[model samples]
Target chain A: MADTTWLTLAPAFLLGLTGLLVLYVDSIGRSTKGPIAVLSLLGSLAVAGVAIALPDALGLGPAGWSFVSFTLLGMFALALFVQPGSQNRRLIAGLSTAGAVGALGVAAAFLFTFDGEPVNPFGDALVVDGMSLLFAVIVASVTAMVTVASYNYIAEHSYQAEYYALVLLAGTGMTLMASANSLVTVFVALELASLPSYALVAFLKENKGSVEAGLKYFLVGALSSAVFAYGVSLVYGATGSLQLTAVQNAITGEFTGMLGMGVVMVVGGIAFKTASVPFHFWAPEAYEGAPAPISAFLSSASKAAGFVIAFRVFTEAFLQVSESAGEFLVLGADWVLVFQILAVVTMTLGNLAAVTQDKVKRMLAYSSVGHAGYVLMSLAALSGGGATATAKIEAGQFVLAGGMMHLFVYGFMNTGAFLFIALAEYWDVGRTFEDFTGLGRQAPVASVAMTVFMFSLAGLPPFGGFLSKYLLFGATVNSGFVWLAAVAIVNSAVSLYYYSKLVKALWFDERPDDKKPLEISSRPVGLYAAVIFAAVVTTAMYGVFGPVSDAAIEAAAALL
Target chain B: MAVDTSYYLILSAAVFCTGLFGILTRRNALLFLMSVELMLNAANINLVAFSQYYGNLTGQVFALFTMALAAAEVAVGIGIILVLYRNFEDVDVAEAATMRW
Candidate 1:
């Protein structure tokens, strides 16, 4: 077999091993999930390292698929953080392994495309390209981190194993979505991610709040999927093709009217995923009701998948509008305006609503939506003056790079915030903003870590969020969306009030007389994983920004 | 003498509109689910109509696949609603507001 073939199979191979181990260990009554988690994490790390080490000498030409499995591979390493304490130990292990395995499977799917013939016109449903690879890594890593965080987070829960498994499956679905090349593939992959999440959201199945959250999520999620599928059918109706490249080729100037409608429908479907304004009704309830670690995964991994798919569709497929003189395919000006409006509304609503929230989890949910708006600025940048001049296109690339880099940064800060909430819950500390009062005095390490996370989220200097915001807004300004950038700046300032409130509650507030140390059965390897992610994200702000920037630039180049 | 594609399109539109209305208005979780199924079937009608008109089997195959998936969805949706009903006596979604904003 070719080296690439093994590379493609690597994810599946690792996942298969983990699944077998999980089953075997469960049968033997050896419920020590730590070893299984360790095994899967190591497998994931090895696969990523091997994929990255594979020489660039073997290039799959333009018609050929690009090979990069590092994203899913890297996710394996990150999932080591979410280990449960002792109760339902078997379940947590299984879930951790599943998350790792899912990452592996996704990597395999991408790798399978590398040497394969171009299935563009013939229903190659997923294109394994640099862009997909980058996104795959980001989502996978986040999945890994969430899983690792969960082990410690869900230590006392009874259904740890099933929870981990669902998380893994969701990761698999997201990976598939990131690489999806056709409309049908996109729908299936998206559902694969979403269905497991429906279960995960209600993991506390006995709790009424959990059940209600799950139902609301299911109803809204189903509606959104229908909307998305309908949009796909419309594109098929107008263009007579489901393959993205073909759709792009078929939607000419005469077809613009129908294509625009189709685009709106498709965007509406995806916006639900990203929790953008108008389609964002489900986010807060779902996030608040879900177990904290799951919330982290949903917010970070799920939202990133939305943006990746949006980038693939809008930049590569829908934006292939006909230029005058019939030479170039420039993005339409209307898309820029649509995206700008979405950014403003999503950000303003997310931040404004968050300001009034008392529950920590719900506030974070709103914050995530606000960040989604910030990410949209890059998409707006991609469409320059309704024209496809080379300069304008290059500027779009820069904006996209900035947007993508921010996603990478935000994942850490966002996940860390949820992890702290989970920890607070574990310690029997309060989960409301008021409950966090004097946390800096009680739990110094957690409080400090949480403060770092808040500052990062608020886009303060010396943190990853700051760099991401600068890059995103700077790119927008450069793309001639100075006013959009200005609005973003204002939104950032508005976001400060809520984030600072959390900070003040944590550090400056007086401690109550009854404050006590959070009790736990045992500390597992999960915190190590979170610390690694937090460290990387924090240091990345001050160090190694260049590599991430270069990677984003390269990925964006693939789009242009 | 041409077969009427527009007539089929109109039927699809009508069915889809009905499903959409049900989804928007129905407070009962079960009814909302059935409405989603109707909308999916309406999509299938459009697909089959187009496949016949274009002389392509792809859309027909897609419709078949979609129908199978719809069956799976129905099974899962019902199972979930059963759980909901068990937990809360009535299946009214409005009353299932323990997790609401």
Candidate 2:
């Protein structure tokens, strides 16, 4: 933890550079996007290198700070933005690079973190721990990839500069949210991430659906924030504490009804952000309405941030209270049952709705919701002995770790799918199922990549998605939640129908009259190659699960 | 003299519920947005009350941040509404179903 200051300075520096990049690009009149992008990407990568070096110098353990992982992921994701292109190329490159670097720095904080242990806080408003660091890495990695993917995706637009800036800002907000130690920090970070997203959702202003989607997202998001703050207030009133860890000491092992209500309201609010069932109403429209790249960011980075924060807040802090402290109390039993029900409904509804969607983005959005349900089921494994039951809660931690892995894998596959859609849509419109017919005949590379993403999402073997899903569901079953795992299995099966339909359309159906050999004219083939590389590595590494699984398990152990 | 905490909570809850009802029942997008603002303000009131009761500066600071965020949200919210209104001539949530159920 000696060099922990670098973790904070790295992101702060990147954020500052972004403003400078914008100013530089503005001064250059209009054509300097390319150089600015390359410079920014290199700068981000350098910061990431600094982060990686920090771990070696300061060592990992508790001192490496989670921000290191975040910074590295940011560096990797920025690789997508620095692609060679003419469509506001410099600005996209610069912002995307800065965003990635920012994410990496944030993740590094956990590796070099010097905070107290789980359920015990040390930071002013941010709690630095393995759970938060794991999430920081997840958010940074996915954000980097999505930002890179978006570079080519939004190349032709005039407002590309603004788009990249907002995306970067959004990413910075998400990282802050992940490391937030207190409810007050959580709210500020949540809004920081969300407000930018509303604008990004409506970035395609000419599209009516985009405008409406943005409005819907904004209103619902504001409402959820309000509801969440209210729940925080009630918890403050009941426990007389705002620090998540402090809630443990304040709850007098009384007021079961009030406790249950507080937990439910808070869960409901976070659920909206994660797009869990019932609150998942806006995901599909927003995805379909927004540009393809933005859709990728939403489903990947944003979703991961939601789950990570939700997991830490619920399982780490509240779970123990519900189980041990609430013994012979109403809150413990009622809240557990409610979470169980939510898991079932969310997964079931998401999969069923996905099966009916014709638009690929919309279908993926629903699938994303289903994924949230699967993640939520991990909460069912919490032991409720508060911090004291750490020994007995290994099963819950395993499930939680598995959920985290799934989020990481899904971020890659989901965003890659959207990238394919964007690449195809840019050349030819209509993202409906019919439009994908004979895609294999036209753009063989994209079609095949799309197939890989689809199969991966369906949880087929030889893919990272399959391994993650197995880990999660297996852990769920191990935690004595076989029924919940069974539901997840069925949901994954239901998901296959829609996902495979895309594959079938790509390979089997007749080529549409408008189907022409699409040109890979935009960012060269190198960018697509990177996307494919990520997909391949994700799939190929599944066979060697010893290290990956170990890493995840070790990460989860830090939380409990 | 200390003010009753429950009274403030109940009032906040009442206003929040009213906003929830408006969002659910009302068709107009403008009214829907107004309802959301009301909900946000309700949360703000709760924060202030808790701040006073607990004597915590953090609550008041957080309330201030929430207000700033709410303003930004409203700005973006209204911008989108204008875009929708220009495109459809009506800002009714029910009418904006080009994407479908």
Residue runs of model 1 more than 4 Å from their true location after superposition? A1-123, A253-257, A321-333, A385-388, A512-532
Every model's DockQ: 0.51, 0.60
lDDT of 2 by residue, A8-37 (tens): 433423543463344335433435455655
Fraction of true A-B contacts recovered by candidate 2:
0.54
Stretches > 4 Å off in candidate 2: A1-24, A27-88, A91-95, A98-122, A321-333, A384-391, A512-530, A543-548
On DockQ, the leading prediction is: 2
TM-score of chain B of each: 0.93, 0.95
Tell me the deviation in Å of residue A261 in model 2.
Answer: 2.1
Query: What are the TM-scores, per candidate, against the unseen true structure?
Result: 0.84, 0.84
lDDT of 2 by residue, B1-101 (tens): 47797689889889989999998899898898888888878877877887788777756777787788778778888888888888889988878888774
* Candidate 1 per-residue lDDT over residues B1-101, each given as its tens digit: 27686577678778878989998898999888888887777777777776776676757777777677667566656656766777787789898887654
